[model samples]
Target: MFEQALGIFLMLAILSVLIVVHECGHFLVARLFGFQTPVFGVGLPFGPYISLGRKWNTEFRIYAFLLGGFVAIPELGDETNASNSSEAFGVELNPFKKFPIWQRALVAVAGVTFNAIFAYFLMVVMFFSVGRQVEQTYVSALDPSNPIAKQAGVLAGDDIVALDKHPVTSTHEVIAYLGNRKSTPVTLSLIRDGKPLDLVMTTSPKGKVGMVLGQKPAQYIKIDAGPVETLGLAGSELVDRTRLMVVGLAEMVQALTPDFGPAQPGAPPKPGFKNLHGVLAVVKIGAGMVQIDWRSMFMFTIMISMDLAIINLLPWPALDGGHLAFMLVEAIRGKPIEERAHGEMVKWGFLSLIALMVLVMVNDVSALMNGELDIKPEMKEKLKGR
Candidate 1:
């Protein structure tokens, strides 16, 4: 019970920090533009609020609900009905519509920008402190009975220099190359006893290349990166991770669609919530990670930060991307959208977000009740084997 409580506390603390960083992006950018930001809050506004001091004339607040946060900029079409009395203290209170389109767009994008930046910062620290895990591409073992290895005449201790003429530096690259060329011929360049050789091998029916690529024993070697190199590494990692996340999200969306074909005679029935993960699933994952170690917890938090960055930038209503889209349209049209139309759009957008949240929560509950939420680690190991 104590462990469970500790997990919950850690999850909340990490989430709260991420939320504050995201909202601060908006708040700080808006303040820089001379906009009126009355409330900078952590967590959704509910119950009584406690004042956490003021910055730049903004009242920092801690609310009851801890799921997410907001930066209440009264001038930025805020629905909070906050008094404009503070407007008298500065330049005439200009509505968000009166601001330059670029400035408004910047405010809309600032939150996502900060999330990405935070993720990159976490990655840099991780690299400097714990280092990254990497694998070597040398062949350590070969199964003679495996068709691909036998046909290619590959021997143990050979380093995979290339696949299809592309340099292979890691076992991951070899697996990726073979996985994509299942049952197809692939060219493998090998270095054996310091002599280079080339061979063609066809993958087996199950996409196995029948080679066990070797890895140096795992060790944490901190990267000694200069300022410029650190920046370059951080930015590159952020971009690569974001791209991978997009592909993964697309796959998850595809998994949501039901496969209508009849099941094979002896095959097990398809699971209803195969790739869906919701709030409870995330919390459960957080709990497990915290129990393992701080490095694992930090790693998960960094990934979540990046995920939030990408998710908020998705071009859907009530999202940062959606707001930026409206700003872009205004820029192109030489005018802001009609207030009523904008309100209607926001209403629909909010409802859609709520609906999505509901669907995800329902899926999470279903997975929990049906014993599907606990298989993630096993599934991850299986994927790694592939």
Candidate 2:
């Protein structure tokens, strides 16, 4: 229990710190470009900041909300005048009253780049400092009670070395391989008590393996590499993870439409704000990481970080992506749009965000009540079979 609590604390601390850094990237870039920044905060205007600072003598000041931070740049509500500049009323940076379109776009993109760097560094530390867990290729428990195990001649303690000619490294891979019930007669390669063996297993109707396996202690393996190789690996992983998240979100959105299959068959028909997950999910995942081993925990953290970075890149109001979209249009048209038009767009975006939040909260509550969202008792039992 103490271990779990400590793990939760660490996870939360890491998440909070990373988010603050991400926001800081934007704040710093905006400040460098001479934008007027005011208040910067995190955690929905309610949470307290861990650190706060400001430029005392200068025209602009900085504050760290600890929970999160943002630069109150000069571009709010059509006002683009630099804070220190004494320009005409309602006018921005000299000609257009705001920084160049490219400058604004760079400010928006900076946060995302920072997040990717943060994730990469975190992964490097997780891999080298903590070490990676070795692949577990054994079936720790066959549970004689499980019919599928019996049918496949796989007894408890049997070491499953491979699946359909593919090497098995972890219990996760074991389930993923055997869980293919949709494919008839799954193949398996086993090594029982030093004797090599081959076998085939069948899946249940729901594409389940119908059996559970356990894991042994994690083995610490060393990675030998120069700084260049280490940096390359980290960068590659971050890029891949980011790409996966962006593609996954696009697929999810596509799935929500009527042209696709039924809309999750459980919630509302359209994709709205309610689908948005907030701090609750963050807290839960952080808590779960401590309970599990470090490798799983850190891997999950990487996934979540990738998700956060990608989600913020979406083109919607009040988001970096939205700001980016406007900048792009300005770049193409050779001028910024009217202030009134931009304000209306922001207003609609705010309303949409609020509506979506309500839906997500409802969905979270519903999932809690239905016992579908949280890990089920049976699933836990299945995981612990080893």
Candidate 3:
């Protein structure tokens, strides 16, 4: 129970910090360009809020909905909407002087830019402390149903280097290979205590021999990266994680089709909308990770930061990327968009974003009830090695 509380706290705190940093990027860049940002608030704009008074042409306040942050950069677009008022904030939107396209673009991109920078910074700290995690095929435990491998003297911590004389890299490879050859005799080349041995065993009919696998530094060793190497690795990690998210998002969209079916058998489900979730699942999974090792939060935080950056970059209204897209259209047209049309699109986008959030929340609840979000005990034991 205490673990659950800590997990929630950590998740919210981390997210709040990321939000602040993102908003600060826009605020600072706007100030740099000498634009008056009438309001900068932590959390969403609507709902009951308390004003922290004005500072440097910005009215700082904390809002009740603490999931997102915003700054009123008047030059960017229609900063004063129905929920927000320039008159209430005691600042006037400049009527005559608006920043050029380049400046507006910079302000729009700054939030994402800051998120990227902060993610890399976190990566540096993690590399220096816990090093980079390179997941591999290591047996962390033996299942009670241990049929062949356990009886053949396989033990925990044994690295399965090759199976059937072919090198196997990830746990997925090992599981897939064994699952396909159920009840068939196969040779496993394992490294135990730094020594290698070949053991011939037959898998159960289900293709599993009670060997449990672990990923993300649980069953693998860490590589302490140097300064230069860390930079290269950090860059690669950002790109890799971003690519994975893109693929996951695309799969989710594909899953929206009527004909899509479930992926994977005798293993974890493949990425799709069926498994796509929102903040609830994040807190649940994050709490599980925290209970195992606080260091795990670094990876979670980095992923969330990158996810925010990517999600905001989507060319939708009510998002940073949407604002940038508007700027692009404005650039080509040689004038700003009609005020009412732009505002209407933003209103619709805001509603769409909320509706999507509600749907994902429902998904999160359903997943929790079905026990799909629970962390496997075998994986937990592997992380415990730290």
Candidate 4:
């Protein structure tokens, strides 16, 4: 029970920090543009609010429910509105609406931008401290019953150089390359005993080419990287991680279709509703990582930061991306959208967001009841060996 509580605490702490940083981006940028952002808060508004003092005319707040946060910038317009009048927060240099469209757009984008920047910084620190571990693209194991591997004539110890002409330096690269190609024949370039060979194999319906790549070393030899080198490496890693996440999301969407099939024997499970995790799962995973190592926990935090950035940038209503979309329309049309229309759209967007949260939570509970949260047998064995 204590372990569970610790995990929940850690998750909330990490999430609160991320939310605060995101809100701070909006608060600072809004203040810079002379817009009145009266409230900068951590946690959702549904919780009990505690004032955390004030700075720069902004009321900082901490809420009881520590899931997410917001920066409340009153609607920018003429001073006639009660909220904009002297009775409320004092009138600022300019109303939020009076600001140039470009400035407004920047304020909307600031939160996502800050999240991405934070993730990048975390990546740099991770690389510097733990050093990067580049896994070799060598076939380590193959299930004899895997028809695809047997037909492809792949052998243990064969070094995979490329897939369909795309150079692959690691097992993850190979998986990402093949995972996107369902029912497509792929050319695998391999080197075995100093002999180069080409083999062809079609992926299963589940998009898996039944084989496991060699595990990375238990201990990596850290290389000291200069500032320039570290930046380059971090940037490249960020791009790769972003690409993988996009692909994973796409796969999840595909899984929602009725035709989603089962995984092949000994193959990793296919993406499906079962893969949709919620806050509970996140807390559990975060706590588990904390117990394992600080490095792992830091890496998880970085991944969550990037995920937050991407999710906010998605062009959905009530999201930062949705606000940016409106700004884009306003820019092209040379006028702002009607206030009523904007408000209605945002209301629907909020409803949609809430619905999604409920759905994910339901899925999380179902998974827990079904005992599906445990690691797979194969993965468990691998972890034990490590």
Q: What is the per-residue lDDT of model 3 for residues 248-348, given as tens digits with 9 covering 90 to 100?
A: 66556765655455654666544555556888898888888888888778878998888889888999998989998999999899998888898899889
Q: Write the per-residue lDDT of candidate 2 for residues 85-136, one digit (tens) a residue.
A: 2342221343324457777787888888788777777878866775543545
Quantify all predictions' global Cα lDDT against the true fold.
0.71, 0.63, 0.80, 0.73
Off by over 4 Å in 1: 46-48, 53-55, 77-97, 135-219, 224-231, 257-274, 369-371, 375-386
Predicted candidate 4 versus true structure: per-residue lDDT over 125-154, tens digit per residue = 878877654444788888665669766798
Count residue pairs with overlapping backbones in model 1. 0
The candidate scoring highest on lDDT is 3
What candidate 4 gets wrong by more than 4 Å, as runs, is 1-7, 75-97, 134-153, 157-172, 179-221, 257-274, 375-386
In Å, residue 348's CA in model 4 sits off its true spot by 1.3
Error of 4 at 353 (Å): 0.9
Clashes of each: 0, 14, 0, 2
My TM-score estimates for the predictions, one after another, are 0.73, 0.65, 0.75, 0.80
Q: Compared with the true structure, what per-residue lDDT tens digits does model 1 show for residues 1-386?
A: 79867986888788878878888899889989988776777776657777887767677778787787987765555333224424522223334435677777888889888987888888877777776533337788887667578566888888787888976555665776687778988889988888999989788766787887775433344567786887687677667656657766765665566878875686655444535566677877677556644455655787788888888887776788878877778778988678677767877887888787888888888877887665366333322311
Task: Single out the weakest 10-residue window by summed lDDT for candidate 3.
Answer: 214-223
The runs of at least 3 residues in candidate 2 whose Cα sits more than 4 Å from the true structure, single-residue gaps closed, are: 1-11, 46-53, 56-68, 76-97, 133-220, 260-277, 369-386
Query: In candidate 1, where is summed lDDT lowest over 10 consecutive residues?
Result: 377-386
**Candidate 1 colliding pairs:** none
